[model samples]
Target: MMEISSAFASGFQGFQRASDAVTEATVNINQQAAQSSNQRALETPVESRTGPSMEQSLVTLGSEQINAEANLKSVKTADEMLGSIIDLRV
Candidate 1:
């Protein structure tokens, strides 16, 4: 059905976005960590950094992981519904 197909597309897109977001947040965290270590090694003053804090990035990662899970579930539900429809028709 159109609804099921749409659900499939929506879920897939949502999952992709969440995955990208998680990846971005992870990269940001890693970059910040690397900068910190490098700074400490050099014994230089902490450079002014402008961006989401580590805590915020961690939160984003956590929330995006949850979103990815929910989107995967939605895709699975849509697939199951499609399968049930085919089973009924056949």
Candidate 2:
């Protein structure tokens, strides 16, 4: 039971990390968008493109969303497992 609780704690930490990554990605996407717009206004050539491409940013955001959802599922599963164990012991 101690081990199970530890595992769930670890899982929760992982979820927290994933949530941080999502936040970082969102900030990066916003920065990239601003940079791209500025570059466009300057009529910069495509060869001089900087930061992540719009498509790449969108893909990253999508993947992060999936990861967050998976993490949430894991946390829920862990909670249910713990509950079951407690009920069995009782």
Report clashes for each candidate as comma-separated counts: 0, 0
Measured against the true structure, the TM-scores of the candidates, in listed sequence, are: 0.97, 0.75
Model 2 misplaced regions, further than 4 Å: 42-50
Our model 2 lands, by Cα RMSD against the true structure, at 2.3
Query: Per-residue alpha-carbon lDDT of model 1 for 36-58, expressed as tens digits?
Result: 99999999999888988788999
Candidate 1 TM-score, C-alpha based: 0.97
lDDT of each: 0.96, 0.78
Question: In model 2, which range of ten residues has the least summed lDDT?
Answer: 45-54
lDDT of 2 by residue, 44-67 (tens): 864544666667777877887788
The candidate maximizing lDDT is 1
Where does model 1 exceed 4 Å of error? none
